[model samples]
Target: MQKKQFKEVVVEVKHVSKHYKIFGREDTVKALNDIHLANDAELQPVRRGEFVMLRGPSGGGKTSLLNLLGTIDRATEGVIELFSSPITPESSDEYLAKLRLEKIGFVFQTFNLLATMSAYENVELPMIILGKLKPEQRKKRAIELLTLVGLQDRLDHLPSELSGGEQQRVTIARALANEPEILLLDEPTGDLDTKNTVEVMDLLLDLNLKLKTTCIMVTHNPDIECYADRILYLADGVFEKQAINIEQTRLDYDKYIEYLNAQTHGTH
Candidate 1:
């Protein structure tokens, strides 16, 4: 079997550290301590179209690393670059926001959908903020993405009316609204049941394969790591190990659909 080859470095972190000072305390907490993603001898870049998983115990700075990679937060020390461009602490907020809007997508554990907005509207919100597409274009694209995530029937449903899995799917559709090159997910399956988690993971895998989108996800579930090309384990705000998943399996959409159909028929 041939090994999958990755092209172009998407993210690079070098000796990064993040620190926070506690209010009313004399001590400073080190959220991340001297994290080096790519060393000199081994340049392990997160390449385009790769699924990289960050796994660690709570308070290990996994979310913090994801936040830095997504450009949501700046590292207190060291350097981070996206697509070879350095994302320094001095980078303007406007620039970072624009970069995030244009090149990056984010999915949160909370499913962060607006309660008042219908699924379609929730998906359309990103494009509206982007202001690049016309009303018809946005609507058409929103429908396409919602359909892609198997939520076409739930287009008009509000978040409250949808199940946790359905709401998370809506969020995924919204994240893809601008067709970002990189997708950042923070514990996407944290709130989902086993079946829903599998479904969501399948959808993500399909998207990553079909769209060639680079994905960086923070996960606590070891089962989720099976789909990742590489897993970075962190502890106490530092990387402890990096493991390449030789047995990583790609979920075939056709087979997945067939399984879903069989389950539906069996239920009825």
Candidate 2:
């Protein structure tokens, strides 16, 4: 396995930390102590076109780090550089919102699709919000994205009509509606069955390779870590370590299912 070649920086945290002030609690909860991601000294930063996964035990601050990277929440201290733009605690909400709309895409465990919107509309909503395209352009882009996610035939299907996997695919398609530079996913496959989980990860890998869209995903499944170029382990609100794959590989659906079944049997 060759060392991963450090590329352009997409996300970097410089000694960042986060603190939460509970109303009744006298001491602020330190969600994240000092952390570092993008740096040349020993630790390497996430680069453009890289697939990075954050993994750790519960309350390990994976989501806290992710939130800071996503600009959904500002850090209590230090700076987060997104595409070389500094995100400080003082960064305005308006600026962050605009940045999120223009550059970042998010997909979550639950398919937060609008119940009334069909697949096409859901995919088109982002572009509409950004107002980056005309109605005809948005329509064309929506169809293209749905097709890209293998939902061309289900364009008109509502969220309720689609299966969990299909709804997730729609969510993925919608995330890419505006062609975001980076996609931040939180437990994207948490609600999925074994088969769907593998399928969604494969789809994500395909998109990552084909589109070169950097993926920063939070996942608990160690079995599928092969899909990432690098996996960062977070614990106690700090980066514990990281592992780099020889090369990203997709899981064979049959073999993956078999492995899961074996694990289940062994556990009992």
Candidate 3:
């Protein structure tokens, strides 16, 4: 085995746990139970420009962990360090909001593009909220992002007019509008057909490499694990195991589709 290179750590989870309270019940649903990430030598910490994937069974707290890491939800116990700054349940919402706006970006299974907004407008919205760029600057960045995502020609098209893959590309462009250091993706390809899935993952891998953005993604597809530098498996709300890839890889669309077809046919 090759000695894996390590980089500066950008995100750390220390003994983090999460649970949700039922509005009218005494019983609370435990989502994560005292999990550690990027904390041990065996489980290497997620570093700058590292692509990590969280995989586990349904209801195993994969999305919950992603949410906590993204600062969209608070951990019930322990703290998560983002860019070396600690975030606890007591962290101020205002501060977290600012951090998210300036440092973190998110893409989800649902594209979440506004129905009435064009691709350019969707991509521009984040910069508008951040308010760091002038109107013209935002316009230029929006176009650049859309072009980067291969949607330059679809800039004026509404979400409804775009295909599943195109809608996902728009979402990815929108997520990058603020030039965030970390991009959190929860099943960004979950809604796509196999062809689109291959296309979208390839695009994400390209962007991750090009922008040097740390990517933490939650995915159910094990076949695509090669895209990640490290894969963390969560089961019953704990880190079940971890796997590190010496190098990132992509799925060739034609070969992947052929393999899927073989699997389907072989089952008969």
Q: Candidate 1: misplaced stretches above 4 Å?
A: 1-3, 39-43, 250-268
Candidate 1 residue pairs in backbone clash: none
Model 2: weakest 10-residue lDDT segment is 1-10
The most accurate candidate by TM-score is: 2
The alpha-carbon lDDT assigned to residue 74 of candidate 1 equals: 89
lDDT of 1 at 261: 80
Lowest summed lDDT window (length 10), candidate 3:
1-10
Residue lDDT tens for model 2, 123-162: 9999999997999999999999999989999999999999
Model 2 vs. true fold: TM: 0.96
The TM-scores of all predictions, comma-separated, are 0.91, 0.96, 0.95
Global lDDT of each model?
A: 0.89, 0.91, 0.91
User: In model 1, which range of ten residues has the least summed lDDT?
Assistant: 36-45
Predict model 2's lDDT versus the native. Answer: 0.91
What ranking of all candidate models by TM-score puts the best one first?
2, 3, 1
